[model samples]
Target: MAGHTHRQLAVLRAAAAGHVEMTCSREPHLYVDGLACCDPTLGHQLAGLLAPEPAAPRGPGLRVPAVLTAAGQAALAPSAAA
Candidate 1:
């Protein structure tokens, strides 16, 4: 696995703990603890780390909690801790 930036790793950690929230869109937005993440790149990076959640069919503005994939959890492992 490629090394992740500090910010990317932070997002992964938050996602693993279910502390991240995300919007389903072309350019998804991510929030950590109800505060928006200003870094747009984090959202793109998380695309690979997080597994897609089964979203309910609802209105346009739906924000779902984020979940990490196995790879993401691996990235946060002690050896891979960045």
Candidate 2:
């Protein structure tokens, strides 16, 4: 099961709340346009959290595509799940 840490999830959620868009590079690295409020650690954390399982092999380092799921968007909303 792929899972993210609470902090990582929080960053992702926050990003969505701020209307920041995320995308994955060809190298499979997640990038956020309005993530100035979030630190590198938070980004790394989010990447790790949303990363695929080890068996799947998502590439090098802790970088991956930054596409958030519907549940992730919902979680980012302050009025939604925290």
Candidate 3:
């Protein structure tokens, strides 16, 4: 919430808005095509944001789920001071 990049904040906001499904993997990559936007992370960061952890599905494709939590929603909120 304090040090995440603009991209990182956008990723979480997208998830909260149900704009796209996130698939965090070992491979460092991000996706954006039309209305489809994929935010790929190192898995650990997303794990900290969501709960229960993502499943370790077989194969090379990303198969984990990344849903925004309460704190995540707050992160997207505008600061009251601002």
Once fitted onto the true fold, the runs of candidate 3 whose alpha carbons sit more than 4 angstroms away are 22-42, 51-65, 80-82
User: Which whole-number lDDT from 0 to 100 does residue 48 have in model 2?
Assistant: 37
RMSD (Cα, Å) for all candidates, in order, is 2.5, 8.1, 5.0
Number of the top-ranking candidate, with lDDT as the measure: 1
Residue pairs in clash, model 2: 4-49, 13-76
Per-residue lDDT of candidate 1, residues 1-82 (tens digit):
3568888887888888778888877667899999999897678867767754656443345677778877787888887743
CA lDDT for candidate 3: 0.50
Better of 1 and 2 by TM-score: 1
Give the alpha carbon lDDT tens digit for every residue of 1-82 in model 3.
Answer: 5666777777776566544344444542333322334443433454455432245453444544456677766666787114
| 1-82 per-residue lDDT for model 2 (tens digits) | 1355565665565454443433333223344554443454454445433433324334345433344556665555566543
Over 4 Å off, model 1: 55-60
Which candidate model has the greater TM-score, 2 or 3? 3
lDDT of each: 0.76, 0.46, 0.50
How many Å off is the CA of 45 in candidate 2? 7.6
Error of 2 at 73 (Å): 4.3
